[model samples]
Each structure stands twice: as structure tokens, then as C-alpha cells.
Target chain A: MDRQRFDYLLEAYGADFARWPDGEREAAAAFAAAHAAELTEVLQAARALDAALGTRRVEAPTPDLLSARILAAHKRQRGAGLDWRAAAALAACAVFGVALGYGGGLLAPVADDGDYFASAFETPFADYDGDEG
Target chain B: MIDPDADLVRSAGAGDAQAASALVRRHLPRMVALGRRMLNDAAEAEDVAQEVFLRVWREAPRWKPGAAKFETWMHRVALNLCYDRLRRRREKSDPDAGLYVADGAASAGDAWLARQRVAKVGAALAQLPERQRSAIELVHFQELTNIAAAETLEISVEALESLLARGRRALKAALADVAQDLIGDADGVPRV
Candidate 1:
């Protein structure tokens, strides 16, 4: 990296090579080593700024209540999801039952209604007449 | 990209309690940290974290590992939520909004001094423009890679670097005195 790029990165990322772009960390470190005397002031200034900024301690401990609340929401969501799925499954079963009934009726053998009715009467009448005779 | 959170997200989506808890364990603190930095209020930061996770639960079922990782998406969501809150505060124009309240029970000595220093740094950070502050927060504080930070901010890498530089420059000027104090105390002990 050139002086201008190195300076630019140093300004942006500070003295921590870890914060620098991965590809340029080696080059930036090498440049700093090669030009330590010239870059000392700027590096020190960046370090100071880094140190100053570091003073703001962000202590964000996740409270148990918050975690419980979030997980409870997830549970509620999962419950709602389960209810929807169950409803869909029940509706599917109803549809399948109706379809099965209709299909079975359609597939049943047809019969001659008049002949059947007459045969029913004839058999009973014949039995009565034979008994009377 | 190999998303570390992909499996957890998928399992959580399918109602895996362990996975859901694991996801929360991994990301809740960071989300809270981001919100704390952006909003400067612990309660509000917690609210933001809750809101972000609620959105996560909603989207988890449909979360597709796309261009961004889950964590990156989460940071974006947290930031947007913070932005929304910030905008509302601006609209309300509350004079006391976003001010850090010192704990009454804080004991004296180094603890109090450290709290003061923290407040000073926070105040200096508050002076920066939102984008610049966000750039510094993401890269420096969150320790996100430059590429990831740029993606989180939805800006080009070059633009992200520019923002970082500008932010750092402004912070250097603002926190000069504090920096000196922090660099070396009266006893010449480095107190970073």
C-alpha cells in the first residue's frame, strides 16, 4: 500500500491491524514497520483516539425476564402455527371423506328398479298364495 | 457464504426450543449492545432487542439464507428499529431524550470516575451524525469486518471507510482531553 492509502486506512481503522481489512492488514503492518519513525505521531494519535473511544463501556447483559419474554413469544407463535396446521389437516380429512363417499356411490353397480320392486312383491305374494292353496 | 446460524434458524423455525434458546443466547447480548450504543438508554436498548427478536421469530419460519447472514440481517433490523425510535424522538423533540442517567447507588472512587469517563465518551459519540456514529459503532465497537459493516449499512466498502475516517476524526477532536487522560494517568500508568 502507498502512503496515502495507508494513511487513509489508519485514519479509518486506527492502530489495530485486526480492525483493518483482511487483505491489507499484512501490507499495512509492513508499511507501519518500514515507516515507524515517520508514522509514529499519527499512530499514537489514532491509538489515543481508540483508547478514548474505548472508555464507553457498553454493558448489555441480557436479563432473564427479557429472554423469557422473547422465548414466550416464540412459543406463542409456534402454538398458533400448530393450530393452523391442525385446522388444515382436519379440513383435508373432511374433504377426503366426502370424496370417498361420492366415489364409492359412483362405482357401485346399477340395478333395474322396476324389476326389483316387482320381484319383491312377487316373492311375497307367491309365498302367501302357496300357503293358501 | 456459510451461514453459521442457518441450521439454528432452520431448527428454530421448526419449533426447536433448544435451537431457539441457542439463537437467543448467541445474539441477544450483541443486539442489546448495539441498541445501547445507538440509543444510549438501557431500557430502550432492551426494548429494541426484544422487538428485533420478535421480528426474528416471525421471520424465522421463512428465513432463507440469502445474500446476508442471519446475524448481519439482525444488526440491520436492530439498527433500523433504533433509527425509527430516534426519528420519533426527533419528532417529539424531548429535551431530556437520549440522556444517560447515572445510577444513584454508584459508590465513590474509581468506579465513579470510570462512570464519568464513560459518560463523557458517550456524550462525544452522541455529537456525531447518525451515519458516522453508526459506522464507528459497527466497525470499531461491534468488531464487524469492513465488508460486513458495509453490507450492514447497505453502503459500498469505500463509502464505509470514508464514514469511519470522518467519524474517527470527529471523535478524536471531541475526545482529545479525555484521550490524554486515558492514555496515561497521573502515576504514568496506562489506563486504557
Candidate 2:
């Protein structure tokens, strides 16, 4: 790994370098002897990186997170349909309330005209209870 | 509600409330993973992932299939979200989550031996740049093809290669020591 060749390898492979070709093995070995100093620096730096990253561990997604995710999936499955049902239910309730209120208002004239009807009946111009029985 | 991915996407696009939640769940993991890799923090990753999924789910009706894979699209959505996160998110969080290797006492067994070697490799992998980390995870670790990985990063093949090369170089530098430690004298394998 001469300075020039080493630089080329470093450039060619960098941190993402792959295993050398089988044919390149003999050549690399020969070069290694000629430039052991450069090889050591590059190789050691690479090793330290590997060691550091190797020791940093991560567990699989936690059981709680998995369960939570699944639960969320289920909730989503249940939720979209519910929105429409809720809106429909709300609309029905609104219509029902509106109709009820309108009908109540319509009956107000009847309630308010009771005195007028009673006066007319008492004057003998109309019958309040035509069939008293 | 229905299968969030399909049902909500269909119904919610047609304007349904319940569909939204289903969509959220369906897309959450990728969002989280994207965020995890981008921000390198679970809590922050969750937040960013949630945001991405929510934004995409809102537009699910407009989602056209055949143009892209669902997972790929989700990844794109996430990477973009993570880009934003990377811009503003602090780097104070833990490093073990993003691109990392396993750690523990290698017990006296073959499995331990394999783990010891693999761990060294993983540690070496961790020292890579985020783009390199992403590429390696996409290519080597996750087994995604170059094209697929490229799509996820929205980069061309050549660009992906560039990222991969740098990543590999970093790994080579990092792992050389472990290789030396394991290999015996004259860079030979150590005696068992």
C-alpha cells in the first residue's frame, strides 16, 4: 500500500470498501511489505471504528412499542368507520331535534289561540265541544 | 374502521374521520424508523414519524399506486420528514439506535464467537456518516438493492455508490483493528 496506491484504495473503497479481489491478494501482500507503515495507520483506524460501533447495542423494538403499534393499527381500523357513523348519528339527532322544535312551534298558535276559540264558543258563534259526551 | 392501510386510505380519501387513525397506524413504523435513523432518538423519531404519516395520510386519497411501492413512498415521506428533523433536531441523543452493533459479554460458545466478530463489524459500521449509514442499512444490512435504496434516498445509482463507497471506507478504517485483533501473527487467523 504505497502512499499513492494507499490513497487510491482509500479513495476507491473509503469506509464502504469491500473485500479485495482474490487476484489482488498477492499484490496487496507484496505491497503490504513495501508500505507497512501506511497500511497500519489505515487499518488501525478502521478497526477502532468497528470496535466502537460493534459495542453500541440496540434491542429490538420493545414489546410495549409493538403492542402499542398493533393497538394503534387496530384503533385506526376502527376509527375511520366510526367518524361517518358519528357524523350520521349527529345529523340524525340534529334533524330529530329540529323537527321536534318546528312541530312544537307550529303547535304554539293552537296553544295561543285557545282564548280566542273559547270566546267564540262562549258567544255561541262556534262550538268548543260540539259533542260534550 | 377497516384495515387502516387500505380501508382508511379508501374511505378517508372519500372523507371519513375513522380512516385517518387507521392510516396513522399503517404508516407509523416506517415513519418512526425514518425518524429514528434521521434523528437517532426514539422519542424524537416517534414525533417526526408521526408527523410524516399524518401529513401523508391526509393526502392518501391522492396516493397513486403503480407509480411507487407503498413502502418506498412511506420511506420517501419519512426521509423528507427526517431531513427536516436533522435540520432542527439536536445531536445530544443516544447514538446506539441509529446504525449500531450488538454489545454484551461473548459467552463461551460458538454463538458468542460469531457475535464477537459481528459486533466488531457492526461497531465499525456505526462510525459511518449518516448518509453512508442510511445507504449501508438500505443495501447491506437491510438487503435492499442498489436501485431500491437509491429510490428511498431519491438519489441516482452513482450518487448512491458514492455514499456507499465513503461508508465502506469508514468501515474499513474502523474494522481494520478488529480484523487485526482476530487475525493471528502476520495477519493470520488467531489460534482457537
The TM-score of candidate 2 is 0.53
Which candidate number has the best DockQ? 1
Scored by TM-score, the top model is 1
lDDT of each: 0.85, 0.57
Q: Which regions of candidate 1 are displaced past 4 Å?
A: A92-133, B90-107, B186-192
Tens digit per residue, CA lDDT, model 1, A24-122: 999999999999999998988898898877766465457999999999989998999999999999999999999999999999987899988998899
lDDT of 2 by residue, B1-192 (tens): 122255456665565656655555555655555455445577777766656555554566676655656566666666666666666754543443443333345455744555555545544554566678777556553445566678888899668867866876766666665555544433555644
- State the local distance difference test value for candidate 1: 0.85
> Can you tell me which runs of candidate 2 are displaced by over 4 Å?
A1-59, A66-70, A73-81, A92-133, B1-40, B46-62, B97-129, B179-188
- At residue A35, candidate 2 shows an lDDT of 75
TM-score (all chains, Cα) for each model:
0.81, 0.53
State residue B33's C-alpha deviation in candidate 1, in Å. 0.6
Q: Which model scores highest in lDDT? A: 1
At residue B77, give the lDDT of candidate 2: 69
Alpha carbon lDDT at A10, candidate 1? 92
Candidate 2 has a DockQ of 0.10
lDDT of 1 by residue, B9-109 (tens): 98999998889999999999888888887787778989999999899999999999977999889889998998889877742223223434344465676
